[model samples]
Target: MDRIVRGLALSTITSSVVMAGGYKIPEQSLNSMALSAAYVAHTSGADTAYFNPANMAFMHGGKRYVEGGITLAHLPSNEFQSLPAYSGESEVEDIPIPFLHYVSEAMGDFRWGVSLVVPGGLTKRWTTPVQKAIAEEFTLKVIELNPSISYKVSDHFSVGGGVRLIYSEGVVKSNSADAYNQQLALADIARDMEGDTFELGYNLALAYKPTSDINLAVTYRSNIDLDEEGTATLYGGGDQLYHDDASVSVPLPAALNLAVSKTWNDTFTLEFNYERTFWSAYKALDFEYTGTGIVLTPFDDPIAKDWKDTNTFRVGATIEMANKITAMMGFAIDETPVPEETIGFELPDSDAKVFSMGFRYQQSEDLSWGAAFLYDSKESRSIKGMGTFHEGGAFLTTVGVAYEY
Candidate 1:
């Protein structure tokens, strides 16, 4: 049944930001967040290292740039109500996410850079009766190290690519007392194992500038399969009834972003981005158990996901306000990959409209500090057979410093 899918799927929610759009977090940095991830074709600083490495070639007389920051994400509680039966509320805790980027000054025609970011993940918990039966808590944490290089083909064109090294870990848990039987009562989970793993992927990009005031770009990130292998234990009557080594694998999905940006009068800039996510790679969640043991309950079943690919539209505008402060705002229409049948307790995700605002204070030609904020407004959905998801969203705040030489 799809019951087990909720447990396995919830384990896929790696972090607060990854909770967006089926585990993908587009806002990895301050400027990227402030611009609603529309900074790809209009990179202004070191953040180009990840969003558009090719644009690093256009930093203009700058030798090197570095930016570091953290995002504080406050996740709202999720309210669930089903016809003729279940109802409850669950919320993931607030999370603090950190990231860093560095782009080298061009030496000849080549520029190199590196980025440390959280690409995707899952985190959710439930204490209510209905969902607690199979999805008490599911958690995942992931980190990625991306290093890249760009080649300036000419004054107007550039190309770049990078290798992705991703590290991840996940856990799943669910238990109920006196739910199915009159005697057995138990609840708890403990584990650490070979499931902590590292995976690899790649990305490519192209940037074109028809004029110094116009920038256009496209980038593609390949999919990475996070296969976790570890020990799993199931309890009954306050004791361990099943114990064994287990394994499960899920995809991080591929994504493509295309953007066009224009600077007007050298003071105002606007950019529009179209992004596509390949989420159909996940059809089901199956758990494998090995050695002298048995799989039971949530771990013994396969859950169907049948997720589909989705798309998003984003636009951002930046205005240089005064001597040093540049203000910006962004808007996006984000689509959800999860289908109606698969939506469950672990993640109450849905299509969303996002609004963001922030500003950057340029301390000097070589130093700057900035802050940004965003509100994700998830659209409510009424399911025919499933529960009613009282749709909600998250608020994220970010602050950081950058330097160039």
Candidate 2:
């Protein structure tokens, strides 16, 4: 499988406010955050399980490394005020996102690893009358469990693959009267839905090392169609459609990454990475409902997304500081997938540039700890067809500990 995930960028809300181009969060670990998600080629820690499992084959023999961490995120306020009395900012709180990973040393040229991570998600809410009609609230929570194994074909080549299981939960709210431009106004109608689903996918990776200082890696994460079904409650407007069936099918796009890294002497290492996300798979958002006559009419229409694929470029550096401590910094430029015609309040996204920094401390022969921070600077966008507003940046901080033997 070959794919690069799409963006989940909405105005930052909650503690885990991770904003990228669209909705994909590649920074799942401390090192990944520090490196602006460009650590694939030079991966050496437990995060290798999620970043580049193939690199596990080059780890020290007969050793096990486990690491765990949590990241804190903040998305500032945003405002979108257009005609027709539609305007409002967001009220988002801080959130903590936790992750874990483990990688085992090579055994007969075979190595294995596992990871529990959050690939991407979204959270947003609005209070404005006009904005509330089409998009009052939209939130998504996801967790992924991946287990992988790698084989060393030679001293210079290794290949790896993993199974991906994702659990997704979501809440969506909107006003039917507003959604139809006041065409169906029985009492300012609104629809609410809460549901959860599970999906399956896979990923593949290849790692190549030329000599001891240079490494190259390429990885692909497959796409998953999120199939969700839950209860629907239609309140107000003489249309009492409550506790009914509701469902929708959305996509988690695939991602492909290519990276190259090398160390100069013993002091510094640098890496560059390029990512391609297949957002074209997302063409529309169509809701399905099974309810009484005329009950399902308003919410069953298809909303076109017309999203396009995107490209991301990342570069990072590591400095071997004194006392078993190391410093890292990175930068990245990411693109958005949403077309201007489809941009709206429900999922306002844009291109972005990010910067990051972090450090790690080795406490002993068997224990180590790390911390990192990243900031996202979103670009301002204006769409004539879709009246939306996004005015904010995002902040992320992470701390982790590792044990090795």
Candidate 3:
């Protein structure tokens, strides 16, 4: 029971290679995806509400800004090669994510904005006998709503903060009724679990413009714990063994970002960003079960997760061309928090290089439309005694419309 529960808990929290360092999805808007999440300091649209609310204080007064978009994500299957019987490939996944943001007209020196976005999620399924025994199916979905306010302190400085309302749902399933388990003299063990939770946090931002051509910004998002409570059904020897209530807790680690941008001749802009993720908050996976006379073995002990913090660097270039067109390109280097000693099937993550490009066209005086594409290339990782994982990566395409009135 303990072993199955541990696998379920991990798969439910972190398993998708399409996400960022952990299970976080950082590209929630057209500009964000086009710039590999490097649009923090030089935001020019309603998305400022989500990336850096402080920028709203500096926006053009007497106008309302609105932006909405959707992203299509395609994740390729991960190939594991080693011993023939131990080798398998994870199933391919395709997902659609949507985002919306709005900024209100200024009221004196104050401004307000709101955003609806998907912050993090995951989905992984393995059908091979060996892999299925650990993670047959694991899925997680998350959503967030943020409302923020900003104050213009001076000509060059502004401050803002927001409340984070989050909701999440998860499903986990595993089975071990196979010839390999029979060879090991083990019983036909299996488990099914479902859970959901709602949590709260906060975010803060600061923006400064010392000169007309330069911009600087900083942002922070607080951590929130997801306490998932649900029911679990266990099986042994193809027979129902136990049915009981279960619960587990995991952290949606905090993050901090520092960004700077410089514009040349008011036609070209370049931006650089640094991001820090505090994944160290996740130390262990402990599941509690409530059932009388239920033997707790292997499943009762807490599993160690000793994950470390990670850093990401990004750079972007934007060119304002003639004919009401804007072109953007970006690159990024991302590091994984999962250490080799603790890496497993649930989350086999690695360092990656990201590339992105996009263009926006101004169709009318008050309407604009754009499209963006991003590619995440992951490096192959080798485990000491297990196997090597290769050919893992993700592709994303985003389309959006913006209106100002």
Candidate 4:
């Protein structure tokens, strides 16, 4: 019984929320989405504050920059095929995410900026009997507030750092009583859990321009542990088993980005970015319960995650065209951190390829607007026990406006 409860609890949280490369959403702005999150090196406009704050020092010195946008995300269902009794598909999901960024005018070689963004999250649901027993519904949401400062150290070098304030919420639900459970002779079991947390971290950035048309940048974000405390209700055989205080901790892993860009004739620019995510920080999932008279055996034990670090490569092209229009296109190759041994219904993640494109039309010297579209295509994955997962991906559309004053 304890082991069953433990396994159920672990799966509930593990399968909750994930998007790009282990639940990290790197595209937070119009330019970022248009370029498939490859805008780090040659960042411009207000978004520079979020992508590479060090670039803030290089913006036009006398004008304030502001940018705001929203993204509409559509996540298609994931299809699982295996034994006839275990085959199932997840529900499709649609969500709206908004973001804002601002950069103040330089105050003698020092500049300040701020950003509000949804850095990561996603929701997955399974209605089939077997799948629902482990992951009926799992959702995770995250918001981040970042304020940063940049210093122009020389004619060609700048440095920046920021404070990361993040808030996260999680929901997990599961149930048993289906044919599969009955076949195993397991008693009826169910669980419902909700929790939230606020955490802190930091980010650092460096930008260097060795020539008029070349830009190089590097950025690092520290990891944060979200310790969520809330209540959990467990049921067994149609009877309430335990209801009390419950807690769990998950890591918002650290990441490092290195990028470079080159411009030709001041009209065409190309950039490449390499990202490394330290998902190894996510070592385990352990839940705590404070319910009197409840036997906590395997329920209190730690479940190993053993996720590995991953690498992603991205390339983008931006063209300054006629009619004050700027066009951009990007492609990325993303790797999954979840190993086959640990993969499950909640997070059937796999390697992916991303493609994106967009255009911005300058309305005037001070205002510009545009839209971007991105598509993530996941490769089919074969899990030892779960069989094969296929037909899963995400589509995003973004509209944004930027202004200078």
Candidate 5:
């Protein structure tokens, strides 16, 4: 009885803000906000291993370089929803993710790189004493690893490609009594799900330099899926486990980048970049619980997302100070990919605008330090489901550092 309700509350809260868009591919956004334009500028060092691998051919110095950083973002929501049968309102848990990249420039005309990214992972827990009856808590984790290679087509044009491997796991708990008595007990069973899967895919990146002050770049990441085959453990006074081959396919949308930059002088530069996310590929998040010898089909609904593609625009400026210190600032408007009909407690997505700032300082000829901060204002989101409606907003912050040799 207790486990069933706890699972619902947990699942609802954990997936709310971060997975709000359902298909989140913002791993690159996790970096220092000042470097928002750096992907095309190739401004930093090995971080390019994840943003744009072809940039490796453009690297001037060492044959090999490694870059890594951690990001912590907080979601403080102001509005929430609660059912009479349930105990309290729904709120998200804390979120923290880490990323690393490595690239080698030598090995003939070919450049190679590997990236471990937590791009679109999420964690949101909701456990209020009053709300513990309907749902207790939920947690979800996802990870991706990519290896790539880039070949220099010419001095002015370069192309790169790679493969992606993805892994995912989750836990859901709900109150048996609240769900059974209130007629919402389908997910009342407390269950733990764990699985791992790998997919093969590739990416293409192009950079054309018309002049030293002006350059054009574009990158495209292919789509992939995670066919997770695992078992679901239901533990109570005794551990009764359900073994099934459950599969969840999350599409990695394709994207297009168009950029233009100009250098005012050695001390100042400006950059503009536009990106389009083909989010329409992410129509629905379908989890097929492959029932075993026992025909254990719980519920069935049409699995179609009907998502629309979106575009993001960013403009930034960098000012070089004395002693190799560089100051930066930028603004960006991002559109939400989640459609109104599909928006649910699992993902509460909304359109938002971001304001960011950061800096880089050269400590020595061989080493440098970078710091960046970003503030994402809350975007009002409304959800209509199960004869109920919810409206709310969310806030977030990101901080990071970079190193190069």
Candidate 6:
């Protein structure tokens, strides 16, 4: 019956990369593609509301706009060599994200907005009988509620601030290995995670325009300590098959980004971005005990990633054509966050490069539509653990739409 506890556990396939690898940052890469030169230009969609809320202040005709949309991501699974004899078919089934935003214009030279989005999270399945021997599957979910305000000091200089409200939920499982470990049958593990929990956190950002044709933007997102509280359901006949209350705290790391946009002429524009993720903070996963003498302890070891700060570089360009049509293209390089020592069935990550393209069409003076495509090819990484070592790489494809009212 520990099926419920197994269901509650979360599984990570390759190392966790919020945007570069795992779940792509649901933001539109095309919005940045079209207006690389405009100080207040952005993709005009629900996603823009999450990336740069201040951009809303400059809405055309000093009017407010509301929009919503979703992004779908696919990553095929592969055989993995490591501890727990898990199957190689573990991969992301499908990732769907939806969001909404509200922007207010010219608040006395200041702009304000609010955004509700799913920034980063995942659900992975390890179907191999061997892999399931260690643990069957894992799931994680996150929701962010952000409110922001910004001020324009001049046409070239601007600043902004905001607060983030985040809710996170996680579930994990494996064979009973310790006195603290929760025992469960593979079938029962899947039902426990059917439950979820929530928590809160905060963050801030800044942007600057240095010249008439170039603009730079930077942002910082803070870490969150997500605690899960829920009941574990039992599937089979057993005295201690399920628990009424169980809890755990997962550490979500923080990050920083620096980006620039340049205009060469009325027809072409370019953009570049550098991002850093502070992953060292993710040292371990803590589980809470309900009984005194001792209940069950699973993975209570010191888990540390020789993880170094990761870096990401990107370059994008846009071409403007007749009758209000625009095209987009871009490329990027991303570093892996997992250290070989800490890499496991949860996340097998490596360095990678990305290629993307998109387009926009004007439907009328007040309406428009946009679409984009992105592909990521990663370098194969060799990992040694759990008595064996194997090498593999990952590929990701993302497509999304945008609407500006």
Per-residue error at 314 for model 3, in Å? 0.6
Each candidate's lDDT (Cα)? 0.77, 0.78, 0.82, 0.85, 0.57, 0.53
**For model 3, where is the 10-residue window of minimal lDDT?**
11-20
- TM-score head-to-head 3 vs 5, winner: 3
Tell me the TM-score of model 5. Answer: 0.79
The digit string of per-residue lDDT tens for model 3 on 1-405 reads 233334433332232212234546899899999999998999999999999999999999799999999998887888878766667899998989999999999999999999999988877788876567666777777899999999999989999999999887777777766623534214356667777889999999999999999999999999888887887676656777667887777788899999999999999999999999998887877767787435234345666777889999999999999889999999999998888766766567788899999988999989999999999998999877667988767898999999999
| Total clashing pairs for each candidate | 9, 19, 1, 0, 22, 32
Q: Which ten residues in a row have the lowest lDDT in candidate 2?
A: 1-10
lDDT of 5 by residue, 83-130 (tens): 554433556545666777778756766888888877565444445433
Model 6 score (lDDT):
0.53
TM-score of each: 0.91, 0.90, 0.93, 0.95, 0.79, 0.78
Better of 3 and 6 by TM-score: 3
User: What is the lDDT, from 0 to 100, of the residue 248 in candidate 5?
Assistant: 53
Candidate topping lDDT: 4
C-alpha lDDT (0 to 100) for residue 281 of candidate 1: 83
Backbone clash pairs for candidate 1 read 12-122, 13-121, 13-122, 13-123, 14-121, 14-122, 14-140, 63-105, 195-229
Which stretches in model 1 have alpha-carbon errors above 4 Å? 1-20, 83-85, 181-194, 236-239
Query: What TM value does model 3 have?
Result: 0.93
The true-versus-predicted C-alpha distance at residue 119 of model 3, in Å, is 1.2
Name the TM-score of candidate 2.
0.90
Candidate 5: regions farther than 4 A off: 1-32, 36-38, 61-63, 81-88, 128-140, 172-192, 233-243, 293-302, 384-405
TM-score leaderboard ranking? 4, 3, 1, 2, 5, 6
In TM-score terms, which candidate is top? 4
For all the candidates, what are their Cα RMSDs to the real structure? 3.8, 6.1, 3.3, 2.6, 5.0, 6.2
Judge candidate 3 against the unseen true structure and give its global Cα lDDT, from 0 to 1.
0.82
**107 Cα displacement, candidate 1 (Å):** 1.5
